[model samples]
Target: MYLNSTSPTPESCEAVYPDLASAIRCVREQWCELHGYTEPFCRNGVWWVFPPNGVIPVCIRDVMNSDKGQWVRIGRVSVAILPDGSFAIAPKSTSDRTD
Candidate 1:
């Protein structure tokens, strides 16, 4: 799903899945395998916070506006995850001077 750029609370955003099974499978298979980390999977839209010793909950959102649109937003920033599971956030462009 595409992310809203003006989303208020990106960090606390909850991904709405079509069904419980899909969501659980995603947490068990995709999320864990991709991050090399595991946390308790939630079946009902419950929020989970892993301790410092555990893997941090990383929220990834699909980027749809870029020419090379294969990217995800990580903590209010855009990042490209590589095939090996490593990722790097795109640096803030100088043209973004609206502050």
Candidate 2:
């Protein structure tokens, strides 16, 4: 979500959702609108969208959560948007380290 009046990458930031399905829907809708894509599919640990009439799927965002909060990938870093709207750099998982 928008961090404040001056924050850049506002559209690329994360927001809270009530459940996993809602979070996935939010990402799919936003990514499709911004990039003119139609379909969303997940492979590996990343979520991707198909370009209109194109073959390759583009990685748009990753939606995840833990006991801490909701996590999303922003550029090269994964960040947690806590329930209170604070931010934190999420600790890397084993899968992240290999990537």
Candidate 3:
């Protein structure tokens, strides 16, 4: 899946996966590893928030992290992977603690 983000460059980047299920698995695992977040059975046509500053797809955490596209955090933030093999995010509060 790809999410447009302004990082090293303002360009649309993608996290390559064998398939959608693989992509979801990476994201869900990141959620749990980051803070032990439990993911529900992902439903179709739903936006799954990866969260602001949260690593997405999580397949490239070591290489890159938190690559949210387009959407920015106003105060609080969240990211969601749409059913279209794409990603979306919204401004919402998360339990993520700042250090």
TM-scores for candidates 1 onward, in order: 0.24, 0.39, 0.31
Q: List the residue pairs that clash in candidate 3.
A: 48-80, 48-81, 49-79, 49-80, 50-79, 51-79
TM-score of 2: 0.39
User: Which residue runs does candidate 2 get wrong by more than 4 Å?
Assistant: 1-16, 61-99
List the lowest-lDDT window of 10 residues for candidate 3: 69-78
Angstrom error at residue 47, model 1 = 4.9
Candidate 3 scores a C-alpha RMSD against the true structure in Å of 13.8
lDDT of 1 by residue, 1-99 (tens): 222254323343345445434443443344444435445444345433343356665323221123222244443554443222333245567897678
Model 1 spans > 4 angstroms off? 1-24, 47-99
Candidate 2 weakest ten by summed lDDT: 61-70
- In model 2, the Cα lDDT at residue 69 comes to 34
**Per-residue lDDT of model 2, residues 40-78, tens digit only:** 766775666677788977665432232243355545554
Candidate with best TM-score: 2
Candidate achieving the largest lDDT:
2
Candidates 1 and 2, the one with greater TM-score: 2
